[model samples]
Target: MGSEIAVRVNGTLPAFSDFGSDNERAGEVESNPAMKVNTSCSLIIHENGKPTKHILVDTGNGVCNSVKQACNDLLAGRCVIDAILLTHSHPDRIDDLSLIVKEFDNVHVYCTQNCWNDVIKKFPDLQSIQHTSVEAGKTFEIDSVRITPVSVQHSNDALGSVAYVIESEGRKIIFGWDVLTFQNPNDPLLKGADLFFIDTFTYNPHPETNHLSVLQAYDLLKIWNPKEAFFINYSGFADFKNAENPYARVPKKPMTSDELAAQVMSDTIPWGYGWNERVKVASHGMVWRSTKQIEFMSPQFSEDMVKLFTEQNYVFSIKKGKKALEVTAETDIKNISYEFIKYDVESEGRRIAATTKGGFLAKPLQMLLEIDDSSDPAIVKIKVGGGTNIKMIDQDVSYQKDIHVKRVHADRLRDFLMKLTS
Candidate 1:
């Protein structure tokens, strides 16, 4: 058996002069004049038997004062953080980094060149400590753990954002925060892995340039298939508990093409997705874990599959003598509909076969398998109103449906489908 490592959460907020308690200070920090804090900071403790490695992913607003106190109070001063890994240069993520560097003399700070520049530009006082400017596809080792930085698209205009893939004790874990989407769904760097932590900022029809919606994150969960996946970087609009659709948020802006290419480099960056069950409404100190196992519960699909079906506009049709059936539809982003035509066929003997299409068909279908089962051999045909389409296929079929200009579930059906699928 591999080493049993325990992850201790050393999260903290900024220390305000007015607030006497840390909790009160965190509340003030969120609405203060310094910066509009959108997310919290986190510290990960990776211990492999006698050799322990402490990795701090983000230094929240309070300069890590909360983390140091929390660790001392929780772990009785037994935990010694070895290094700091920053996901981005956002104020909420790196405000306390300078304080951390000054306090810990032996700790090595790791971040992208762009993040480094942004930090130095804002806080010139942090120029003294050792800083390693990380590049995409490069791996750095600290004690028994090896960390690889993967570039991610962010809303900033600086160097770029990044996610870390940490390998230790024979296990690989990905820390993906503040990313819009997994750049290339087919990229090898996003293949099989033990665990993944992703952004769950919004749900569907992403609103801004960066950040992942609840629906987008689920779609990624289906593709990456990590043993365990958790959502981070939440917003005030999110309500994890009692949330009918649990994962839903407005989309953000997208990362540039160059940023995407730089982030996904290897074929082994494991995949998984889930909401932040602990902290809802932008609360702090939420965490989740993944169970490292790859099971074929259903067919794993991607954005490419959605595109292929829509681009061809092939409808489902049954041949006089054939066991397989096929259909397709296409549309643009503006006039896109969410209703997907599920292709199903009931053979003369009641053997059922079916598939679905919609604005985001692949992910919904993947989730559908978890709740229901298809029966009978009847070829079902439907159209995915929105522009999204399936990019990949798995099984072989014989019949094809040529659906031309059908618009029954154009609006109501589309809305219903978005709610169900997302």
Candidate 2:
């Protein structure tokens, strides 16, 4: 059975100071300084829902609470901490290990010899917990998961930080946090990963700290070429609110194509988005299942399917047309949080239509999906809106039916339609 990874928490310590102050920019303080508990991630690995292997990568302050909740929510049981894996002895990463172990029994803690000693020094009570020393380039098995520790440079060399390559069955994940620089670019552990969770403490091109910057992560992704990647450990100065956009922040000054390419490589502006199509910023309670087992079906005319889309707080519908499937939805176009372009609008139209016989103006967002039984992928064109604002003379406009275009992935809609209409 293949292992599935789920994020229990998602965050890192403040890059600047404990106060989370950043005079450098405005509106950047939303990066979890007040809520450090949301920054650190605790992951649970499971297979077949029988033997769940709970491997915690880090235990930042207040993460134990998040993990406990996640276990109950995801596994449908109480927290079962099978093992605790430490990337380093940084206080932010290992502060809550003692508290977490208190809630469980027979928990094994894995880390480097130096890190283990430091952990013991910091949390003397953790001495009772079983310890397994790991060395760089050596593989260790904790339950069914095989992990290879690879040393990486961080601010504090005394603790001796190391990254990990966790493999189960044929799937593999590279977890590298608190990373400043890699010892070897071609390290065997750094190659061939299904998913990579790395550090992104700063968003600047030239970061003063030893931690990895967003731009640096882009370069690493180009070299490693993982199937998917996620940026963790964001700082206050990093772009937090506008992470959904193609570009986190557009450069104020213009430069040559070569210079522009050097800075931003990804299509989306956020640290994770533009570097690779699959890469995204890791968040709390994010669950990833390797294979789609088709657990449930969304048949046509099912109210459950509409409820699923309605729960998103957006207006949308899936209609089974004779020739094809039709999907219509609307989202507020005023929100600039997401900056993206999809397939350069093949053709668009906008006209004021009648909402009723009284002639109230109404605008609508529409997309058409053509089903192709052939091997080739279908050309699905989706329009969030007609790229125009809805204008009605009446301010109250009670009769006007609102239609602000909502962008939906055509492929996903197509797949659901195939299953529902099948």
Using lDDT as the measure, the top candidate is 2
- Residues 1-422, candidate 2, lDDT per residue (tens digit)? 55555544434443335323433322333443444463455556656654376777778776777676666666568468777888888777777788888877788888999999999988888887789999988898876779899888887654578888888767788888788888886875687688788876666543445678766887887788787777766553433434556655553232221222233334434645334345555543455544531111121245224311221123445444444333344332211111121111111211211111121354332222232323322222222332222233233321112222122333344444445434
In model 1, the Cα lDDT at residue 252 comes to 24
Q: For each predicted model, how many residue pairs clash, with residues at least 3 apart or on different chains?
A: 66, 14
Q: Residues 1-422, candidate 1: write the lDDT tens digits.
A: 33443333333222222122233223544455433323443434434423244577777565366556546543356546578888778776777776777676676778988888888888897787778988877888776678888867867563468778887666677777678755455655665656666776533444463667545766776677666555545442322222444443322222111111122211113331232221122223333222222211111133222111211221122211122222232221112222224532233212222344433433432101111113221122432221222322223222223222213212222222233223
Q: Which ten residues in a row have the lowest lDDT in candidate 2?
A: 334-343
Error of 2 at 236 (Å): 5.1
TM-score of each: 0.50, 0.64
**Which model scores highest in TM-score?**
2
Model 2 vs. true fold: TM: 0.64
For the record, the alpha-carbon RMSD of candidate 1 to the native fold, in angstroms, is 17.9
lDDT of each: 0.46, 0.55
